[model samples]
Target: MESIYWVLTWACHRRCRHCYEDRFRPYLRADLEAVVAEAERNAPLVLGNLPKRMTYRDPGGPDLPEKMGRVIISGGEALLEAVRERVTYPVIEGLVARYRDTGGVKVVLQTTGDLLTPAIVREVAQRGVWMISVAGIDDFHVGMEGEAKRPPSRRRSRQ
Candidate 1:
């Protein structure tokens, strides 16, 4: 159950008022090889308690040993338009493919519900990733220090 989280990029579409207004930049390129190497070194240590002969599926539909570890790909809104336009989607997909090919780790994705399109969900399913959507209600002011911010319409459920 060891997990590695990689922040592949820094670009986001929606700006949270709390985010630093002056510090916004996208990751031009991610060092995939470095990230993989780090995962390879740390995954086994994290999964020390897991069974020794575990098996898992790779992105290419092959089953491989789960001796290495689990990995998670995340970013500043992984599904944000800026990230998608930059390197978020490709890096995540490539990581999943490599993890599956190696057959030694699990892959998960963290995202905002705003970008969970049907096609994206299908692709995630095919890659055997566990998608976690983070959302919550807060009474704190969005822009002002104490003023409450109104919830966005996109968060409303259609039931």
Candidate 2:
């Protein structure tokens, strides 16, 4: 496989007309923590076994094989304030640290710009996110108001 398209959560801050996902869930902190732990344990092995095609060359150095390829993280909005700093950030950091030596894992974050702030952008960039794909800006996904579509408070216990 070329890259892992990881959906961190189905919860979103928008109810876009064009969205493919019809149902959303309010993912709790523990749920996210558990996911992070699981990913941390298994992701490297899965990625390592994938076909390595990317090659990295350094000045006055030999070409090195890229062990892991890329990790594309997406969600209703991965940058949503509810889970950004706690869950999402840790995943990005962990991936970067794990594959920093072997040509580095290209971490791509996908989101809608509704919840992104300058500080958050800066932090993710620093944490080795190679790209941020902003989506849902067209007429189908207009009306950025999030209250109507917002899932129940993520802090609430799952019923």
Please report the candidate that would top lDDT against the real structure.
Answer: 2
lDDT of 2 by residue, 32-142 (tens): 455445544554455455434433443454554334467788875677666676568877887776666556678899987777779888999998899998775545665
lDDT on C-alpha atoms for all candidate structures:
0.50, 0.66
Number of colliding residue pairs in model 1: 3
Please give the RMSD of candidate 2 to the true structure: 9.6
Candidate 1: pairs in clash = 58-100, 59-100, 141-147
Which portions of model 1 show Cα errors greater than 4 Å?
A: 17-68, 101-103, 135-159
Per-residue CA lDDT of model 1 for 1-159, tens digit only, reads 355666544544445565544222333335433433444454334445333422444556445533456666665556654445335445545555555544555666766455678887776667566555453124331232222233454344546
RMSD of 1: 10.2
Q: After superposition, how far is residue 48 of candidate 1 from its true place, in Å?
A: 23
Q: Pick by TM-score: which candidate is best? A: 2
